[model samples]
Target: MITRRAAFCLPALLALPARAADWPLRPVRIIVPFAAGGPADGLARMLAEVFAPRLGQPVVVENRAGAGGIIGTGAAAAAADGHTLLFGSVSMTIVPHLQAQPVPYDVVRDFVPLGLVGSTPFVAVVPASSPIRDVAGLVAAAKAGPRAITAANSGNGTLSHLATELFNARTGTAIESVAYRGEGVLMPDLLNGTVALGFLTLSTVLPHIRAGRLRALAVAGPARLAGLPETPTFAEADVAGLEVDGWQALLAPRATPAASVERMAALLQEAMADPALRERIAGFGVLPASADRAAFAALFPEEFRRWGDLVRSRGIRAE
Candidate 1:
């Protein structure tokens, strides 16, 4: 009953287009800038375990480890596809500014913050025997003897050093930086009162704090940490803008598709929501990531700028 023109149109309408494939056609390689066997590397493996079976591909963490993470970060910056990701840290925002030479990538320009993992705050800690019991007390003591108070750090450009710099700037005090080979040597000095103070990683100092070997004055975070609820945040302690912590996160190359990034972010948040994972992370004195991706990403630029200014002004070097 169809007319000749109608019959001719029916064939064109009946032709079907081919289906498009799902994303991540192959294994996804996650680059960790630090060396293996470290806490960061351990966390990366934990995440990869969650991602691999569900991602429909093998998820691998590759440690590129050198130049304070510049080597692997540069490799991540050069990634051309969504399959390559970076399990970066607060160091990504820091190490570049510490370099006298220009880094291979710009933190903001080269990558987008994919998701937040967690952070271990820098606690203002003193030997249990010290008289200082709070931020005000610590500040007063430092002010009493300018440049006489010792703040321990593993090296010149580490987060501990930067936190000490920020604390000094915020409190209008000058505490001298005391460098150590690593925490192994530094912890003993702190225990024996050879070092008066340290803005140290909570995980590294938590046991000591709990064991009554070191006293935590204030935690550099938005609010009091669950592990140290009695310890107030810097703001609550009357020191605003003194928050300092080493955050762990994922970032993707900027050129990666927006859809893919969104999907990955959702996946990360879902993984972070696991109660067991959060508990495990918290057991190490690290706080679990919040569900707010936008809020977390919004913080990156400010933190990046803050650390950069401090690094440049302090003339921090890699050695």
Candidate 2:
């Protein structure tokens, strides 16, 4: 017999299949909350190319750069279409804590982490001519004089900035951080030997390192990079709490359907598994670290707390 409850439940059961089938009915937009030509934008475009055919729809890359990625991230959080996703970076975890103003979206509440694209290690670099050949040398220099060694970073609250702070806290050095608008501005000073040291991503500093303009002292990761085999990791250098990577991930609005998130996760897994794709990402100096939805979900909150604690303890602020 069809009871009153069964009658109402029947419609919802029928709708589930329809919702799953109708997903990706239109173009999927991946919002990159940074200026074009940066790593996040490049990654978004690459993912778009791979996701389009798999999702049976065009995956459009949108740049909504402003307020240090808040504008686009907020837009992605508010989107209910399920077709719109966010290509977020470690900044997503760090920025909210650093901002003086209230953030529009909550990392844990407003979004679901669909997948982790990968992470790239930051390198501790000095000008090619600097005598500081390794982390220990740099530390000794910093201890010689307070704020004597100027440590430059791309911006305040960035991974580079936080890493520099962590370095100071862990090693008991007072290397002052000088924040710049972007890497473009920071690199020039770094190359000119104006800044004593920098904590920058491999991609941003790789060209300089390869061109003999910058020297890599250490990599902030668990293991030494294959390309920079000679460089030791922070842990290897006996510097703990500095082993963090600048990671990117795909996230959807929290209200997005479970089926759609699962499908997106599968497509991302397939894309990351492709040898050609992995090679391409590596060419850009990013290691492919694609994880399933569950893994990413677990990783996101931990990162959020980790960065938050760092920011608060250091009193790091964003301009």
Candidate 3:
């Protein structure tokens, strides 16, 4: 003989199993906002390889490159299913402020930061035969006259462009900037001395520097890079308050359950802690610096504000 209260609780108890189903009911999709063969794509694929076995499901990497990561990122933010995730970079913070029209998604509201992948410092490089040997030399030449030094960037409002702008602002020099479609287009001009200097990812220019085609005068980070130990950092070179590092992180749609988010974060943290995995990521030219969900959530707001201020102050606009 069941009491009235027990009868009322039976239906709820019976539904618990269905309500508490494990996440990843199907294959998980990791969206890379940039094109394949880039740093962000590489990171996503590496993460997927580790996540597949941990989550007991397939983890697929999807490249949805367009508009400097806006299209793919917006798609990820709008995804209703928890199965889709985004592998984003610093451009996630920078792109919103760059657009003239209103952006479709909100960085602070539309998605939850799952974990931070890693970061790589940008290296300031010039042709090996160029007369500019260091940051000071570059500054002195730029201050000598208007348009004295021409710097090339991958695109308008890109990390490379902002880095050059930050250098000019901090050092009180006027280095003219030339924008190219992408790094592939900019590399030729940089190597041939058509452009005076450029800030590029360490991985992209490390070979050139080692092969005697380009000279790395300074790196953009708080400390010097291990691969370019001889090169000083921007702060070390007397240009204080000019630190920038290209970082990548994972994000999920806002509607995703907290349990799923936590599970993914735990899995990522465990994978990032593996020494063998760290060595492989380091080989790709980025430092392995993984953060759990809470840390990543705190980091996003700070970075968003910092990049927003820089973009507005420099009057940077999209092309």
Candidate 4:
């Protein structure tokens, strides 16, 4: 059934992969949309250090931080060449939904998720001295006087803010959500009991929790974290729909070749297998990931839709 024209085209189709695989002709840059000192920056630097030599080119980590990472993210989206990649985070899905005007690019439409890097779950915490010892007690207290129990967040429209809102919605407690400039300011107030409760990252609150300044009531992850082994998950506490695992990933421009994307994802899996790197990532209370491209494809879009639904339902807007 092979026609003369079809036979002529078969050879060209077979050669496509060879052309697509010819990428990273020069140095590759991983764009960290956040500021220079945060988790994305640190992780990207670590990845660059491990992945550069094996890639047969230099890998650079560039910080294009601003507008809560939109500036850098937009820049990466416009990069048609395979040389530029994005060190993306939970904020990507949240930002577009929270913005008043539309952001420069659509995450799902403009970029292809390369692979998952890691994830950290938000933990619900009260001051060590709080009488709210468990999830039930916290909910009961918040319900008693919704105004009395304030939930502190890093800022409006952040994952922390949305987590707080999600908890309130699920529990039927209209607890006031307070915004701090960032976790640094929120931490001092949280320890001093100026803020009643906050759903914060373990990395930001783990030391304080260990020193007995913060009481971790429940974890909003699939299971209890290794660092906080004794804390129960929200579902275990009879509270459902509070799960939120803030994830990290790498993405490339949508126009990048499929072969290049697969190769980069393979490199990520290999790097994640490194014991030293895994230890370093875990030191910050993050779980290292080695998921393949298909997994990444499934995760990112669901996250995008999930956060969008929450933002719209809650009327969450950027600060």
Candidate 5:
């Protein structure tokens, strides 16, 4: 009788949806919670270019920028259709905790993690003509004149700003921050010798560094990136607490069909596994990372816990 009951229960359990395939019945939208042309935007476009044809439906990228990406991300979270997905970066994890009120969306409860796309190192850069040539020199200059260094950040409470703040807190130096609408604007000023220094993604700053328009002082990562081997890692510069990476990720609305998430995740993994796609994106200094349904599901809670600690401990507030 026990064996009979077990056999009956097994069939019922196995009858439940297994997420094997048969997803994406129609067109899909990928929301990028920032302006076009940045790292997140580029990543989304690349994925769309590769995913649309394989999925037999068009994939579109929509840019919804504002309020440190809250406006756009909130829109994505509220999307009712599983066909709509969010392509976001560190801000998706950072903003909710840093805001005084609850953010527009709950990072832990409102979205499903698809997986990390990739991460790039953060570069401490200044205008090429600036007097501070390196991390040590910048620290010394800031010490001599407190809040004298004007650093440009695309937004308040962003990874770039947080990285800069972490550095300030560790080194005990004051760096007055200048907020910008976007990196496109900041890069020009950085190239023209307007801002003293700032933390920007390596992929965004790499060309300028090569062009000799901006000076890279250090890279913030676990180890120095292969392309910029000569640049010292933050640890090498003795800049404690100067460890943070810029990342991109994919997210779906909470409770999206498991089958839908699984199918998209599989296609994404296949797309990333393509050698040409990997090579082209890697040339931009961003690596490709993909995860399956179960692993991807675990990312949001972990990121929420980690970033929430940093925001609370550091008292980072949205400006």
Candidate 6:
């Protein structure tokens, strides 16, 4: 007596497609929230090229830089179609935590996390001629002359700035912070010794570090960098409570279908496993890191809370 109703429903369910087709029926646009030639832009290009073939559509990378990445991110947030996605980074997580007004987008509410692409550690460096040979010497100098040691970063509320602040808080030192439009623009001052110290990615300072123009004091991670094995980690350097690493990720406008999000995550995970892709990404000085949708999505709220606390305690304001 199960009846005709049960018999009719079974066949209808069986007729459903075994598996969904590859989405991205047309060209896809990836919005990079930074200018060309920068790390974010470079990562976006790499992702677009790698992701295109997987989705069977051309993936285009576009730079929409303004207001410290707010404009581009906002545009992506407002985009309803899944065709437009955002190449987000630490800035995306850190900015809103500092802004007085509510940010245009909610990291957890407005964006769907696709995956974590990778992370690169920043190195603490000093001019080649400086007597500060290691972390201890640099800390001693900063302690002796509060606010005398100046460190330059891309801008306020940026990873570099946060790195320095975290260092200061941990070491109990008062180091001055100078913010610039971008890391590229801050190089001249660093090379010329206008800035006494700098906390930047090893990629940004690799040439100089290899040229013997700047000496690496320590890396802001748990372990030493593969490229610079001799340099010690923040923990090894004995800098109390200091550990920071800059990262990049991919996000989509909220409300994208779960099927699409899962598809992107699976493809990205596959791409990350490709040896050739791994080599290329490592060449940029970032290790290729990937996670499934659930794992990646879990990180946003934690990051938002951590950065939010720092912003409130330090009173960081966007410039």
lDDT of each: 0.85, 0.87, 0.88, 0.88, 0.80, 0.84
For residues 1-319, write the lDDT of model 2, one tens digit per residue. Answer: 9999999999889776435556788899999999999778988899899988877899999999998889999999999886899999888888899888879989889998888888888999999989898888998999887688998998878888998999988999989999998778888889888998999888888888889999999999889998789989998999986887888889889878888887888888888989898787777778898657788889899999988998999998887
lDDT per residue as tens, model 6, 1-319: 6678999898888755333265776788899988889778998898888988778899999899987788899999988776788899877888877777887888779998888888888999988977889998988999987597999998888889998988888888899999997788998898888998999988888789999998999999878888899999888988856667687888888866666777877887888778887788888888788655677788777777787878887788876
Report the CA-based lDDT of candidate 6 relative to the real structure. Answer: 0.84
In model 2, where is the ten-residue run with the lowest total lDDT? Answer: 14-23
Give the per-residue lDDT of model 1 (tens digit) for 23-86. Answer: 5678888999989988788888888888887778899999999988999999999998768889
lDDT of 3 by residue, 245-282 (tens): 78888888987777787777788888889988888888
Task: List residue ranges in candidate 1 displaced over 4 A.
Answer: 1-21
The C-alpha TM-scores of every prediction are: 0.90, 0.92, 0.91, 0.93, 0.80, 0.88
Clashing pairs in 2: none
- The Cα error of candidate 2 at residue 189, in Å, is 2.3
The Cα error of candidate 1 at residue 257, in Å, is 2.3
Instruction: In model 2, state the lDDT of residue 7.
Output: 98
RMSD values, in order shown: 4.8, 2.5, 2.5, 3.6, 4.7, 3.9
Q: Which pairs of residues clash in candidate 3, taking residues 3 or more apart in a chain or in different chains?
A: none
In terms of TM-score, the best-performing candidate is 4
Error of 4 at 189 (Å): 1.4
What is candidate 4's local distance difference test score?
0.88
